[model samples]
Target: MILIIAKALVKDESLELFKREALELVKNSRGEDGCIEYSVYEDQEKSSVMTFVEKWEDRAAIEKHEGTEFFKEKIGRLISYSENIEITLNSEVL
Candidate 1:
């Protein structure tokens, strides 16, 4: 299994737009075939900080997800609304 953590620092003026796009992303990504789990979380202390936590079957599943049209559209728009973005991929050791 693969775990993906994506964090975004959203621009203050763009929060509403960012939330809308992020919600759509989470909602659609959850329905993908290889998605074991998908969710977006807002930081308790800092609402402008958001993160996406995902579990997938494997690397191939991630590639396939990246190729989807919705993924392309939403991610692009989301990037535009963020001050910075970071993503990390991990494999379960246990």
Candidate 2:
């Protein structure tokens, strides 16, 4: 299995727009093949910060997700509102 943890510090004025785009991305991604889980959350302490916790069946599925139009369009728009973004990928040890 593959896991992805992503965080973004969004512009204060752009938070709502970012949330809309992100939610659409999450909703669509959850229905894709091999998508084990996909979720987005807001940071309690920082209204401008958002995070994504994701799990996929494998690297190939992750790759496929990256190539999807939904990702290309929505993710691109979402990042435009962020001052900084970080992503980490991991595989289950077991």
Candidate 3:
């Protein structure tokens, strides 16, 4: 299994635009074959931060997702509007 946590810290003024782009991507991503789970989350204390939490069957699943046009375009737009963004990947310890 593969787990990914992608976080974007949007500028205060760009939050709405980020939300629109992100939600669209989320809706599409959920239907993918290897997508166990995909969703957007917001920081409770920091309203400007948006997080995408994803679970996939394996690395191939994630790579397929990254290759999609929708993911590329949406992520590019989000990155442009964000102050900072980072992704973390994890695998089961056992």
Candidate 4:
């Protein structure tokens, strides 16, 4: 399995727009073939920070997800709103 954690720090003025697009991305990604789980959360302490936590069947599954139109149209817009972004990937140690 593959696990991913992504964090985005959105500009204050762009929060509403970012949330709208992100919601659409999450709703669609959860329905993908190899998506075991997918979710996005806003940090109460840091209002402009949003985190995405995902679990996929494997690396290939994640790669396919990255190529989807939802990724291009919705997630792609998020970069413009974010001041900074970070991502972490993990798998069980063999």
Compare the candidates by TM-score and give the number of the best one: 1
Q: Is 3 or 4 the stronger prediction by lDDT? A: 3
lDDT of each residue in 1-94, candidate 3, tens digit only: 9989999889999999999999999999999989999999999999899999999999999999999998899889999989999999999899
lDDT winner between 1 and 2, please give it: 1
Candidate 2, residues 1-94: lDDT per residue as tens digits? 8999999999999999999999999999999999999999999998898999999999899999999887999989988999999999998898
Q: Give the TM-score of candidate 2.
A: 0.97
What tens-digit string does per-residue lDDT give for candidate 1 at 1-94? 9999999999999999999999999999999989999999999999999999999998999999999999999999999999999999999988
Q: What value of lDDT does candidate 4 attain over all alpha carbons?
A: 0.93
Error of model 2, residue 48, in angstroms: 0.8
| TM-score per candidate, chains pooled | 0.97, 0.97, 0.96, 0.94
Q: Can you give the lDDT of residue 11 in candidate 4?
A: 97
As for candidate 1, its clashing pairs are none
Clashing pairs in 2: none
What lDDT score is found at residue 54 in candidate 2? 97
Arranged by lDDT, best first: 1, 2, 3, 4
TM-score order, best first, reads 1, 2, 3, 4
Candidate 4 regions with alpha-carbon error over 4 angstroms: none
Worst 10 residues of 4 by lDDT: 68-77
Displacement of residue 20 (Cα, Å) in model 1 is 0.5
> Which pairs clash (backbone N, Cα, C closer than 3 Å) in model 4?
none
